[model samples]
Target chain A: MADTSETAAAPRTHVSLQVNGTTREVDIEPRRTLLSVLRDDLSLTGAKPGCEMGNCGACTVLLDGEAVYSCLTLAVECTGREITTIEGLSASGELDPVQQAFIAHDALQCGFCTPGQILAMKALFATNPHPDDETIERAMSGNICRCGAYPKILAAARALAGTQAAQQ
Target chain B: MNTFEHVTVTDGNEAVKLLSERGGAAGETKIIAGGTDLLTLMNASLIAPQRLVNLKAARALRYLRFAEDGALHIGALATLADLERDAGVARRLPILVESVRDAATPQLRAMATVAGNLLQRPRCWYFRGAPHCWLKGGAECFARDGENKYHAIFGASSCVAVHPSDLAPALLALDAELLINGPSGVRTLPLAAFFHEPTNDARIEHTLAPDEVITEIRVPGQPEGANGAYLKMMDRQAWAFALASAAAQLSVEDGVIQQARIVLGGVATVPWRATQAEDALTGQQLTPELARTAAEAALAGAAPLAHNGYKVPLARELVRRAILRAGSVPHP
Candidate 1:
């Protein structure tokens, strides 16, 4: 067992992470969450930490194109996995369709949960290009907006769903 | 969360060996799969392990498939999302899928493993937030006398907190078995035998040894004409734990129930098997009245706490609805 006695200094292991099409290396303790590493180390503050536990979806991010709560993910476990944050959503300086819809639909009040919400919808569209209302609601249920922007968020998602379906 | 050394194990045998060698005590060396529940517990200061054995690298254990005998075998690392999206599971054992469909959230389902979900601890406010709860090795159970609207209504000795897993009751009703790897090698345990109410002596909810690593969950083939359903009553439409839930599986032939398995969740310290309810339904005709009788029998012995009396009737109603749905009988 690794020594966890009071006097023992915490061990830090080196980990390589593939974040937003880039390879980043960091030496950190094993307990550091992916959210903390993203915000504190990598300076990607888009993913907020609402609840350090998995209850709030403020820290939602895409891991291998699947939505997951970064607060619940360990930095070390993310090795070799593709991670996409809100900052990475539009790396080409062009707003993604989901982000564009969020703006076009006015889907924000305080905008605290918008990043997580956008990432969640991005993951949904990645898996299912054109989801129904029930699918959209179920997929976005994890991201809570205390400002009651759910109706607007739904409108944005619906607009995107229509566009994607028409294009397909 | 306190900093801890993390080691990744590629297989269950290596995990067991590491636990046996490095695990100083029963709860010191923790095994982390998905880290959905364990990380939360650690963040709450409920448990501070010295080392976490990351099982995410145990790629071999991440599987869901059916055996030739029509039995379902789910690997320990199979996420709840895997079960939710599995068409085979939906066709064969839909109750399992139903139980996991609205459990927590999509992100949680994506990260929570089958074994991790079954092994998660209670969600009682007192046990989770209070520092002096009995389940946390403190003197008293505050939920027994304090606010306990979501507490257990049955089989709570020292801890009135209910089991929080939605999948547990469904799996218990299906009579699943667990394959565990320990220092002595692998052993299979009936799912029913894996859980127990917390007592003064053990104060734990499960029978898994410190060195044991759950490798697979084996659900036996159901008899012909068998069907099952899981019904949960939550405080909200979604993203909430069950206040009371019931899972019922029945094998009926020619409108006569040949066998039944009834289990209740979020109502006891363990996944409660409603044996009396099962007995009431066995050899009986599928009818709304019979379902009500079984539901009544299921909660006949329930001893509700000061503030959780509503759970009795609520659970009874869920049991009734679950039975009706499983037997495909019209509600009267």
Candidate 2:
């Protein structure tokens, strides 16, 4: 905040983030995006930079409990928000229901898109434990699976929805 | 992406002041609302601002509310997902929801904001990845002659790039108004006149001053019992920009069209209003013959470039189908 008019490469700002229930601090260039920081700085390579743009959701992460494209998100913009990545999903060391369902249905082929797809489904089920086919389709549309494992993915989603409904 | 300093501002006044000082000629300083579009531009090196003004700390600008006058007041930072999931907005204006639901994927909607969507640059490959284009202060538009499939089919003068927002057409059909905060203080303008075809000096879309920031968008409530529909034809089944889209709103009084507003997207440099088609529908019954006649009127002055003639028929049919869908008429 000192040099308001410094046009050339303003000094980096210190950013404190609560990523995956753990506090982390970093002093990086302001131009760095959240996806770059998570992958490069923090060694959290789960969120891949498929497009490095908003078009591809391979870098999807939950920012403040809502799913957002990390590649499009500036790291400095996410100062106080809670970030949940694929590596943070299984805190209990047991496979989450979505992961279990994905494995049960063999929802992944090449596995490049699994982390993003799983995180997207995790965010979907957080709000809607039992989603219909259309809801699942709309929610997962952002994460593209180049392997074309959509049928298996849909089966996994349906299986998770059934389990949630039966428990309810 | 070129390296630049990022300045975070907490208030609207501060943001505008910083922008005015640093955002000089040729976009030296640029404002970051949601970064959904800006980041992509920077990533491709299409734009390299000297300084980036991040408004993420301006929490006051993030809101969606219905005012006492029945006008919907949407702040600049209100994300697409916020509009799509708002119960009141959904009940009052399902057309907005429909416009956003099919726009980008779920993650993109969560990151894209109202003002960002409105002010986003075109998705033209030439304008984006190419070294120079007329919109970027270059000599000519590449899409005018080369690979112009997704280019404009109407109202394209020097540049054929189409307006890429699905929300702009929907808002324009509802006659929305925009409030801008700039060096001269706050002023409001009708959204229709806010957008213009690319002029010689003003090559970019929209007439916002470099210092001005869109603060709020106000949509007056639709006429009682009015119905609206949005139809988009995309290249793929999901996660793609519109090849052609239509937004139609009509009010029927005893099976006769009382009022109509028809606007087409992905066919023009701006959200094009099919005023002739709307006029043709006024005081007419919802019939297949009338729809075809109005659709033909909508595409009357369409001048398509190479490889984009398909958009003329696609937009024409969308306009017709959207009108019928808005009127709740079953397909004949």
Candidate 3:
């Protein structure tokens, strides 16, 4: 249990949330963004904070299955929402299809932004399983790979989406 | 970012009650809806509120629907992604969808709300930086004589920062009204009249009082045979703010323009309504020549600052192209 003080200089709140299909709780300052809390508080550092602003998608996460910038989302506001980060993309220690495709297509180099990119691609597939190249490009536009690995990233997305379509 | 007390409100009335109870002249209590813009400003130390009233829990304020009166009613908490995907918005108000489609990237659209987009601060480098400009209670505006290529070319009341919302000009072109909730009561105002030019009060942007909150936005239905379009020119293809943008809505009958509204963005302190351009289209046959003339008329009164003379021509071409596109109706 955390004491929420009204007159404290740094106001704190007790937020109990479901992250990666598990219940988690933290007493944090109100100004702490979800990205900071995920990385600093709970040690879920898969979501990188490249540009603290929303311009960079390196801090992307799924809030209740909707893709949002974790950097701009307040930790307090996500008290009851379900958050899925890159670490939670797979179940039972197996790689998610998007991660498998990334490895198969060499979708990353330097690998700093790989988690965010994989999560973004995972989100795209969640909504549109067979997204075309254009849809993939538009959906992934927010996630910038500074290493210029866009060709591989797009290839990986196409591979995953194609597999879904072929299976259907 | 300065630490602040955070309290989640379940509804508009509760939010207003809290604000009215603890609000002061210095804006000690601030509302946080989407936090896409407010968080950035706080991280930059531009605004330091002692308390934040979080409205994300107010699910009542998150909706988009066409009312019985044929008006499109959007709650303040509706995300830009919600508007982008609504079939009615794409059909009845395609221009609104287009305005938001290219403004920010997908992730931002997912996080930013309608009210947050409408209330976001200017993207001016000077204002966002550490300079205590006129908008920040300083004596003079740094962009008035400084690097002002992206600053205002019209309606610059001692502050040349351009209004940054892509949805504002489009909504104004459609003649929308904003439903506001304050301590006194709920009231509605024309969207065009809602924005105010910067004055001695360095703490406010729109006409919203410190204790007031925008609950919903109502856009009147367009006339039959009315078509609208929005054109935004950006520095790059993705994730760039507009260099200049234009929104045009015109009602045409039998190849003749009956009514027209033209609004320009990224070149004014407010959304600049090109009355001259609208006037040029009324009661006239739609022609490329008329659009060019209307485009010229649109910039007839522009007073560009130091490095933004290029926006005059850019805005002119965008208005002309937008008018032509809006009036490009199939023959009956």
Candidate 4:
């Protein structure tokens, strides 16, 4: 017979995931969100949970190579999927150009919405290397920084766009 | 908050099977795609459905491909992020893309699906607001009597929540059709016919049966002289619904109008198609005067509520601007 505590505990199911190219399996509640799965279950806390809803981009991550809101996504559906968090963007303590440029431009203050902002920039530049100011505005308009660092954020985006294209 | 049950289906057919087998004839099931909308409703302790079926795994509902006839077929599960990123959508259906671009933030867009965006509940202060409203089957639709500036200006005899889509109007102007799947199998209907007048049915937006799911949208290729555009007037540039918006499509021949369509957004219970406006443009010359006349024809029968009387003129201005823009574009 199962233990009495186990019987009363919320039922947890096993899910196989590949985060940043490493395969791992973990047990989680069916209703548990991928945000919690990343922060709590996997101990990859790079992705923050500022707004449990999708309104805030603090918990944005890449699912199967496409950007998605981890907060709104259920962990159960993430099985057999590839996820990329801020932690995976760099290899061996190196900085991705987008993240480095954001710092150089002073694009952040509170630093809470930084991970998501960087990820949004990464996702944007990955597809569009040379987006104009208008395209950048349209793309980054969804991620908000209450600190009003938007001007610097725009500058950082332009700098990264220029650098990313030069290397191409 | 109550813990709701969840079932994930792997394909469109499986989703239909679950709806038919589990929902049965009662038709009280709720379908969830990204849960960007349904979860918000559930988290807020809104209507509690008997069962919640997840369609995120339905491969058939996640594509943005073209049909053999050059018409675009967008699966219901295609995310707004996907829509904005597609070169095809930007090149051929910028009006539709413009609608998606203006809604929500990039984070929400990445998570929100097109079908969910269209089917999402109203954001009326009385409804999403702390207090109860009639849309949730309350005694009074607060929008009827209070803070109704954003309410409907036409076809809203009872309730006044404005239609919240920027793309629906443009899509309607393009004569898009939905491919729906219910227990009875698949069927299709034009987008204009999808929305019902409040008098027709105050409780529902589309004609979709409770057990049905929108599988794909069939938007025909642009005709010989097609030109389309969307305009939205909102308090804020992001995350807010329209104050009043308009979408126009016109085809010209030998400097004379051959075909035209106009639909009003954020001013009705549905993407309000303007038949009178179409009639006014079908045989007229592509002139600023003709566009103004067509604009007047579009708002001829508007019945705006208190505090929203300006919608009639706002709608007229947007209609005129949209038509002039469409008329000036080189025929595609």
Candidate 5:
């Protein structure tokens, strides 16, 4: 019983999406990506949309406490989910472990994909404090760095993993 | 660019209600979740749904559970991140995790829902190109004769875009079930039946009703003393679709195969369940020789397209390797 006509006379509805611990309600274009909502509506530009498609992980954000590509997600779809943008990585001005590690290891050259890469690394470190080479490779495969900063990124992650192990 | 109206639903029932109300002979209404697929279609102007319903608010539709009969019930909205994070899923259905782990980046996995993964549109260039091709309700699929390297080999007559969900084949191997809900009520179908080949339904990838929303995915629990494994062969090591892949589950008793499930991915239209492979392994001793023979049996009837001929051997080899690996692992 699908509508065969191209035009629907109904009006668009407004919705609230929990974004970076703050609820933002806005009117959005039906075709707008969640990336657009976060950056344009809420003005949280921490999550960058490098590739509009899900290919590059540059637009990665945490939806319901898990990392997901924001560019490929719709704002209206995330009405009730908790989101964690790169802005949430720090409480005040203090750097998160993953961020600190990236700084320590110098894990960036041009740094466009840094936010997404750090988030991926942070997620990996949280789950697996000590990841083998294969696991690291598999986990970080999606975030591409044109600057060839993979070795440094791995080093940063390894340093944090070491610290986490020592604390344990 | 064509613009469509957007709607968001809170649960499976609400999605059905929205669809029932919106999709009534005027035009198609789309249910978008992760937007991993829908955004591409919209950007490319391929599918112009008059109404778009977003299902990410459906919390009830995003759970992993064990039903009354020991079935591993996973809500369709369960994201790849959820699958990877769930200790129970990792302990029981490691292959599901392994398959989805390569679906995209960690970011995409967190956003991508299981049902959306199953229902994601095809990745064919023609489908996403500037011109309309056959798969988009046309008379011919452009991939049929042009740039069909990534197209289907088995169960493809008209449209040949390979079903891309990596977790799908693994689920089929373990005899997964999909629970769909719509205006007509609830419907339970096998994961194998969930997706149809081009001959069965050339217009769509799955048999889900226009108003149907995939609510739950149930994988029957593995029997006692059963081991499972999944292997994917791809172009590169990261975030790439499988060139060919296979998942195998086996129950071994005193070094002989007592029960087996063999499923192939990236080789057919749907999650290709290889009955021929299972038949070859039943009651056979668990050995490299036996595993290789069973793998060969799996691809015996495989019909390959022009550019994808190598997929036949690649898929078979993956099956052999996965079976051998699973068979060698001692069951608890």
Candidate 6:
């Protein structure tokens, strides 16, 4: 437990989270969300806190290769599951294909929603390597880009779909 | 968010035992499967519980399969994304897929469970963010006369908030039943009986007791050559709740309707099953004029609030479209 004296009414539990392919331990209350643990505790700030509600997908992350809203996910419930963040996308020190596609298509402005958007696309590509435009739009509809960069984002996703189809 | 002791239960029996042992006070202990709605409500300081029983690890309650009787059985913990991407559901009962396909975002669909979606609280702005509202034990519903563009048009008792789940209406149309497990035992109830209008005495929605938990949802197969359609009209293209939606299932033979079910969503406290509309369609020929008449019958008793009169027309049009689509009737 991190701070027992601060709140004697509630006790904190030790939670082991696998973030970015590494196991990390943190003692926190059950109320702490996975987004808070990722940003404040582990210093993996790639997952931004946008609305804090599930309405906005700014805190999107991959849990067992499926994209889910981390803000709505409790940190205590993520044991034994593979968690991947935006930092994990480029673990090889080279920009992943989705990241490269974003840069090539100019898919972001102000860049607050870029990481969540990219990770959402990464999860989509994991399952459907070559998605059509409707599938791509439906998959990326969760991540809201405030800068009105949807056309470019769609272009980036379409490009990835095209390249993946070519490789196949 | 208020801190609560988190406990993990592997199955329904353990969860029931924990609830019974913990005294099973609705305000004290809460059950969480996906935490998509509960966590949000807690974040807004709506309903605070002392403990949360995590049911995500209940592997026995996370399945989706069809029984030999042609009924599709879905575990309570099955996610909306799981239903959307399921080939069997798409083939056997496509209305379920259509209902959940655009209900929420991709991330939310991946996280929200079928039970949570059915048991989720109302999305009325006043009910959600207001300090005092009738649904939350307040004296009056603020949305009754204020900012009620999204409130209910039908069945407004003390609260005007509308039901938010897109899957409930579709399930009700398919004649779904729930298997509820409690300390007493497991009992099955029709999906229609599970929901009721909120009154001054009963401030909450749904009929699930404090100690009871929904284990499974069984949707019986439709009639032979039956088809259905779910149409939702939202303010945005996606990721927003429905302003008004319609789910219509019909079994037609020789261009005549043999059986029909019409359920409307986002227009009432519960999934409003239009029996009049169903009666109007039964034994009638599939035609655009008949569809319009059925749609009119569905909204005949609607009493809309001042700001939400638009929902009546919107819902009527959706009902008409859903009926036409379900019967494969062409409309100009």
- By summed lDDT, the worst window of 10 consecutive residues in model 6 chain B runs over B18-27
- Across B215-304, the per-residue lDDT of candidate 5 in tens digits comes to 888888787777788899888877778888899989888878889999888876677888988998999888777888899999998877
| Model 3 ranges with Cα > 4 A deviation | A1-9, A163-168, B329-332
In the range A1-107, model 6's lDDT, one tens digit per residue, is: 13212366668889999988899999878888888888888999999989888877889999999999998898899999999999998998999999999999999
Chain A TM-score (model 1): 0.91
lDDT of 3 by residue, B136-187 (tens): 8888889989999898999848899999989999998999999999988999
Model 1: per-residue Cα lDDT over B1-332, one tens digit each:
77777999999998898888754487788899989889888888888988899999999999999999999999999999999999999999999999999899999999999999889988888878946789988899988888888888888578999999999999999999999999999999999999988888878889899899999999999989999999999998779999999999999999999999999999889989999999999999988999999999999999998888898999999999999999988785
| lDDT, residue B172, model 4 | 89
Candidate 2 CAPRI-style tier: medium
Candidate 4: tens digits of C-alpha lDDT, residues A1-168: 011112236666788988988887987656667888888878888888886767778888888666677877878888778889999889568988988999899999998888888888888888898888788887777577989899889889988777534433
Top candidate on lDDT is: 1
Order of candidate numbers by TM-score, starting with the best: 6, 1, 2, 3, 4, 5
Residue A19 of model 3 has an lDDT of 91
Q: Candidate 4 docking category?
A: acceptable
What local lDDT does model 3 show for residue A25? Answer: 91
Kindly provide the TM-score obtained by chain B of candidate 2 when compared with the true chain B. Answer: 0.97
Question: Please, what is the whole-model Cα lDDT of each candidate in the order they appear?
Answer: 0.91, 0.88, 0.87, 0.79, 0.78, 0.90
RMSD of 4: 4.1
Candidate 5 predicts chain B with a TM-score of 0.93
Q: Please report, as a residue range, the 10-residue window in candidate 6 chain A with the lowest summed lDDT.
A: A1-10
lDDT of 6 at B262: 100
Backbone-clash count (model 6):
0
The full ranking of all candidates by DockQ, starting with the best, is 6, 1, 3, 2, 5, 4
Candidate 5 has an fnat equal to 0.76
DockQ for the candidates, in order: 0.56, 0.51, 0.54, 0.37, 0.45, 0.63
Model 6, B31-144: lDDT tens per residue? 999898898888888988888999999988888998888899999999999899899999878889999999999999998999989999999988789558988988988988
lDDT of candidate 3 vs native?
A: 0.87
Which has the higher TM-score value, candidate number 1 or candidate number 3?
Answer: 1
Model 1 deviation from native, Cα RMSD in Å = 3.0
